[model samples]
Target: MKNIGQRLLEERRRLGYSQQYLARAGGVSAHEQRQYEQGEDLPRADYLAQLAAHGVDVVYVVTGKRSTVINISRDQAQTLMDNRVVGQEVTLDGPPEEDLYFKLSDPSGPPPDQS
Candidate 1:
């Protein structure tokens, strides 16, 4: 089995995320992230949970075979799809459901009203 550090390093590289950037996203210091990636240390459970939220499964990071299960219920998947909007914020007239269209927003960047 590959080491946890090696797996994390590979995944991070695959995602094109630098240690500093990932650290910021995971709410850790860059130095700590580097240490974990370099096989010099392991993060705490809370840190691992944060990584899992970012799509890094702890079992895969540990054993390198993706032994973790990624089971999203139908309702959860629908909720996720319903909430997702690219390059814009959405406001719904009611709860998320089928035929839920989005209200595109500016994303608060770039020139306004260019679309």
Candidate 2:
């Protein structure tokens, strides 16, 4: 299984978001975002709040499990349509549903070390 860092990197890539773009959205420096993706540091609650606001799948990042919110690229959507895998072009309104936005924004960071 990939680590948190790898998942973070994957999410960023999936969204086609540059580190700088996420940095601005998350209110962190690019260096900090890099460090988080490098597993040198974990993201905090407030930082995640910003990410959730900007549509980062924070649940997948921290837990390694993806939420139901699937953000497909236009080409992929088109391909699905071409293959008849998807019936009817449904126009989605509003933001893609994110799982547990409340939870991701709750914990201040990784749980405090008990030991």
Candidate 3:
């Protein structure tokens, strides 16, 4: 398993954010930021909260795994954020939409009659 610092550094680089930028955004001294990324010291809870506020996934920070709950098509995601998605019940809190739409592609392709 990767260390916390390594994971944090990976996420930072993945977002194309510089250490200095993250430090400022996360409200920590540059030296502290370097240390955190170097495994010298762990950031306090408040600092972690700051990073999360800036869109850094706290689960990824601690467990190095993606645990985001939201999942939607890029277009749908934007639409939901824009307060749309009315009448899109499947996309809401319910069974997966795939269950409902799966038959459309095979409307006349169901199994042969068992007469």
Query: For residue 107, what is the lDDT in candidate 3?
Result: 50
Error of 2 at 19 (Å): 0.5
Estimate TM-scores for all models.
0.56, 0.58, 0.60
Residue pairs that clash (backbone atoms under 3 angstroms), model 1: none
True lDDT of residue 28, candidate 1: 89
Of candidate 1, the 10-residue stretch with the lowest lDDT total is 97-106
Clash pairs for candidate 3: none
Q: Model 2 — which ten-residue stretch has the worst lDDT?
A: 98-107
Ranking under TM-score, best-scoring first?
3, 2, 1
TM-score, predicted candidate 1 vs. hidden true structure: 0.56
Instruction: For residues 1-115, write the lDDT of model 2, one tens digit per residue.
Output: 8888888888889999999998888899999999989999988889887887777788888899877665565555556556764566654235444332112233466777899
Q: Where is the poorest 10-residue window by lDDT in model 3?
A: 97-106
TM-score of predicted model 3? 0.60
- In terms of lDDT, which candidate is stronger, 1 or 2? 2
Measured with C-alpha atoms, the lDDT of residue 79 in candidate 1 is: 65
Alpha-carbon RMSD of each model: 15.0, 11.7, 11.1
Off by over 4 Å in 2: 69-115
- C-alpha-based local distance difference test score of model 3: 0.73
